[model samples]
Target: MEILRVKEILNEKGWRNKDLADKIGTSENSVSAIVTGKKFPKPETLVKIADVLDIDIRELFNPSKSVDLQEIFTKDENGNLKSVGFIKK
Candidate 1:
């Protein structure tokens, strides 16, 4: 599955593959492979990537789901908690 958000973040930073490669001390081909998802970056490399991009490592991956923190859950009579829906904070 496509998990990494490298390409999207790179676009936001207005950076080319070469720029990232240089900053991370890797080759452009290596960066390209990571960007295309043909290869996954090692943990150390991921740290370097995050540092170069000036973002948290968690931000490098796509969020599996979007959750609204404003949604409050309460237990029903049956004792099952369920989302009542979103509410303004």
Candidate 2:
């Protein structure tokens, strides 16, 4: 489960979803899902988003929510697959 205040951060920074989408080379709909907590981005995408937003990647995570680390990745931050409504595919 995700708990990042992505939308809030975007608002605080005055960034539209289109801005994020453009920065990441993805569609606005994909960015919207992540912003709304309807989906999680791929790790690489997450890194890109964090960079674009000028935030730590950890800032996008919900520290209070505990998702199994094993279920999240196969190798490392840049590796294999684990998805839930990940729209950028």
Q: Report the number of the highest-lDDT candidate.
A: 1
Runs off by more than 4 Å, candidate 2:
65-89
Task: Please provide TM-scores, in order, for all candidate models, with all chains considered together.
Answer: 0.75, 0.65
* Steric clash pairs (candidate 1): none
Off by over 4 Å in 1: 71-89
lDDT per residue as tens, model 1, 19-38:
99999999999999999999
Q: Which stretch of 10 consecutive residues in model 2 shows the poorest summed lDDT?
A: 67-76
lDDT of each residue in 1-89, candidate 2, tens digit only: 55777888889899999998999999999999988888888889988989988998888766784444422233447775655332222
* Reference-based TM-score, model 1: 0.75
